[model samples]
Target chain A: MQENKHIIELKYLSKYYKGSNVPAIDNINLNIDKGEIYGLLGPNGAGKTTTISILCGLFGPTSGNVFIDGMEFQHSAEKIKSIIGVVPQEIALYPSLTAKENLTFFGHLYGLKGKHLKTRIDECLELFGLEKNANRRIKTFSGGMKRRINLIAGILHKPKIIYLDEPTVGIDVQSRKVILEHLKNINKEGTTIIYTSHYMEEAENFCSRVAIIDKGKILTEGKPKELITAKGEYTDLESIFLNITGRALRDE
Target chain B: MLRLLSSIYKELLVLIRDRAGLAILFIMPLVLILIMTVIQDATFRTVKEVNISMILVNNDKDSLGEAISEGLYASDFFQIVEEINGEKITEENAKELVARGDYKIGIIIPERATEAIRGNVNALINKSFKSFNIPGVKKRTKKSTIDITIYIDPATSNSFKNMVMSSLKEFTSQLEIEMFFKNFSEAMAQLMPDQKPIKFDSFETIRYKEVYASTTENEILPNSVQHNVPAWTMFAMFFIVLPLAGNIIKERDDGSAFRLKTMPGSFVTVMFSKIFVFLGVSFVQFILMLLVGVYIMPALGLPQLEIGPHKIALAVMALSSGLAATGYGVAIGTIATTHEQAATFGAVSIIIFAALGGIWVPVYVMPHTIRIISQFSPLHWGLNGFYDIFLRGGDLMVVLAEAGKLLTFFVIMLGVAIVYNNYNKTK
Candidate 1:
């Protein structure tokens, strides 16, 4: 295993969905170093999810290659799966299960068992201020409570690299703050985060570095402040994104 | 390990927490069971009693004709109608009436029937032994055979025909034997020179045993109810599980499956856990309804059954077959894109399985090729298992081979489900 260094590397990774001429993700290269929050900032359909999904090894890229800590996804799928946690854009959680039960089940999938699984669940619940609601069914929970639990579900296994796809998509400010803060703290404790979102302001404030992509291709990449300065009078990351992606409702 | 167990625990918690869904899963099945049992019970009671309507035609104007008619009416075997048979009974008219299904049997006595019996009995014996040897004397002593035509409706059941035939034969044979004995005695007295004349007035002997009579008439009904009820119950139990299994697939499509996946267990473990839960639900529903049938319903005057060892064993085997059904549900759900599709597939599969399994009708009644096709469904095994227990008194071990076949079906379906989920994930 390639240890204690670069967590993710993507080179010439592209995906053309079946029966589609246009590719969802274009050939691009990037390296995600350890213990940093990297954001893939893009408009809808800008290959933001495609990139994160590739890193998670959900499916092989149509062409090109992805390596997690020097191991190819095709050859080291199980190993890669064990190390990386994916929090999808959709709230992927069992609504019928209580928070604790849901956590326990996911923990078991990662081969966790007994007291260790219970302790992890308890700790996550407490950290997210969800300890009191651990026994409450997820269907009874609010959207914010469910989002918090969703984040916690991925982190329970203590994966080295965690992928968050629009984690704060539809939550209230307070929930979003709590989730982002928890993610920041988790990253501080030796985890690499690759986040994707259309929230340019949040990406500017929370991410150490960001890439603005559109039409399945990256237009720019740098620290938000540096990029602002590089493009004269840009003033903010939103301006940079608007200048690059244009004003179009991405419905079709 | 612990994480996998926790995942299973969580899935079950979620599964149970949906109170409406849980209620439907538990209550709906029992309601259906109750309905099916009630219908079958009614059917069983209706098919057991045997009552046949008959037309009696008597042309004999003597006491012997009256006695024959009285004997048939006296027995509880037939319902005798007078208007259907006119004074003159013909073979053609009797056949036409019997074919209309209004009557089970028709009786026709020739015009000379009474005259023939009376002529032989009243004839005075010749006074000479020399005259007894004459051909004319022998011809005069000979008895005529009465033409009593008993027309049986071919459309009537085999058992009903047998009862009618046996009763008629007994009545006619007794009459003939009495006539022959009377004629022989008269002839012997006429030839005896030193014998006192025998008084035949007090010599009447009723040929058949007559039982103690009551005013109450025994009522008979059809026998289809009993055969159809138990047969349908087994079929309903075997086929109902398929639709419930579709609900399992609906949860997966709703994103609950992915949520469970991210938690800590193998999808296989969660799957097996659901199977266990569903199978338990189905089996419990089965036993509860049957208990109601055997115990509580009897208090209300319903026919209750005793739980024999064979019945218990067959119940256990039936449960295993239900598990196989759940497996098929899980597999189908995993492959379907939506709950509606899952439900449709469940319905379609159950119908096909029921048809093949001999639930809609018995395999014996089906053509040979269709019977062979029914062998592929898990329903067939389940229904067969029920038959072994409730009807045929078969035990668990006796149904093991069939149960094994169902278990194989369960395993294959489970494997397919696993492959489907994994493929979807990768795709």
Candidate 2:
């Protein structure tokens, strides 16, 4: 089922950082398909960021291969980058700029310009309910506003696949709802979604399929309902997650 | 094309948003230039009269000696402090006083000096009677025992020494001329033998106008206060703009820059656009400084600068050097890891360049090794360009060498920045 339907494939992907005691990310195999919200669920230090950063073409893997839309990382870095959008763990908006200006800048970075760029920015601002505060500086904005703008910056290019790293980490409930709703709409519109989060309930409802990972390796993965039902006597996705990834807190 | 637009657009947006950083970068330099100009104007005053207080040791007890001392004391030029008569003046005390700059001129008079000027009866008779063996003529009677010493102090007063010397020479010449005329009249009356002692009443009054010439090329000194202040103003502007160019690097470290890097355009295009922005900033800083120098300063007793076409050329050459240096500074700033490091590097490097380039001091006066070191600094070129304009009144051709050096610095620094960025991205 994974091999026939997958749009993104990672095969024997292993990363051993320079002069490190152990691999930052161990051998991991996974597949993500188009029009599906796939969640990589993990606690802290689970190599979630490393995996996302590598897939974004920041660097190459120590060994094995990562294929995006069947194009290998070795040859099609630029093409893959063009088709993919990344919303980083950090709020990547410039604090000095107005909310609208941040989006405009990001929009232009995605090759959207002139009146077309201006229209796209206004649309995104309206969509995020930030139309009134478009002219306000980002530094003066609330965390939720910055988070929304950060999300908007990544999606302005309208890539086929979007990768979001803990987009709701510090956002308010209302802002989180807006972000997940936007992600749902994007996924519905034929864009494959790859997300990482510590929130179990959000992954349970929002993600079509989920994988529990710990210590840089995947423990289990399946459709949320299927994983919950298959694990005997589990009432919800959290019970399934707790039984698999454990209840222990990860500390640096 | 789209990628280039995005890169440039992102840079413009960030620059606009970061007002605090931009303000410090732009207006702070202007304010600093203004403050420094005021301070430098205060410290570097025009070279004028050196005042010396001299103790006049007059031993001439006669009326004539008294008149000489009184004349010198009464004059508006010589500042004379009369010493109380006690012991004879010694060379040791005189040297100490002169070395300390306590006095301008020291006068020593030997005892029994009044007898030297007296014309003896025998001397007069020898001239009248045509006799070789007159008592006063034959006996070398009382060899004029006049020993006088005038110790002039060079440190305390250059002009005061000249003033006192002029007064002394004038007094002696006037007394000799009067004596010579008195003797001539007597001789004429004796020759005529019948005519009453020639009573020719004639008055010849010559009018002399006093002129105080301001050195005017006669003195081969350093440039007058007029040229040096403006030259330094330009230098200060160049240095003050150096630290602000690190915005490029600051943005890069902050993540928004990475977002821009991945924008649809070439990275080099974006870098070049930032260079243009900083160049504009440098231009504004230069103009503001020049305005203060050319208009506001001369009104306050600084040099009257009448700039011609050559001055404009030199100014442009200076501006070009500033642009090149600014370009280099921006490149260096981007290569740095943090804003603090970038700022520190920018400031320290500019200061080093300023020192090496003879902005702090003239290269001509620097040692050979230091002068050789100055060739590596863009600041030297900038200052030299300024010198060519205001000091030498030189054309573009005169500043071409300096401009070329600045261009080379710009190229090297820019090349290093480009290489560093490429290497850093992978790291």
lDDT accuracy of residue A81 in candidate 2 = 74
The lDDT for every candidate, in the order shown, is 0.70, 0.69
Residue-by-residue lDDT tens digits, candidate 1, B1-427: 4543454465466556668766776566555555655665554432333345677777775656776788888876556776743454456777788878667788876676766865554342332434556222243543577777877767766656676677777776666566655655665665674787565543446567745331223211212222333444445454444544555665556555544454333466667777766676667666765666566556655556544456557566757766777787787767777767777777777778777877656688899898888887777877776555555555667778877888888889888977876676544
- Regions of candidate 2 where Cα sits further than 4 Å from its true position: A1-6, A11-22, A27-29, A70-78, A212-216, A226-252, B1-23, B38-246, B304-307, B311-319
* TM of each candidate vs. truth: 0.74, 0.72
| TM-score for predicted model 2 compared with the true structure | 0.72
True contacts kept of each: 0.47, 0.40
DockQ-based class of model 2: acceptable
Give the number of the best model, judged by TM-score.
1
- Evaluated at residue B244, the lDDT of candidate 1 is 49
Model 1 collision count? 30
Candidate 2 DockQ, CA atoms: 0.29
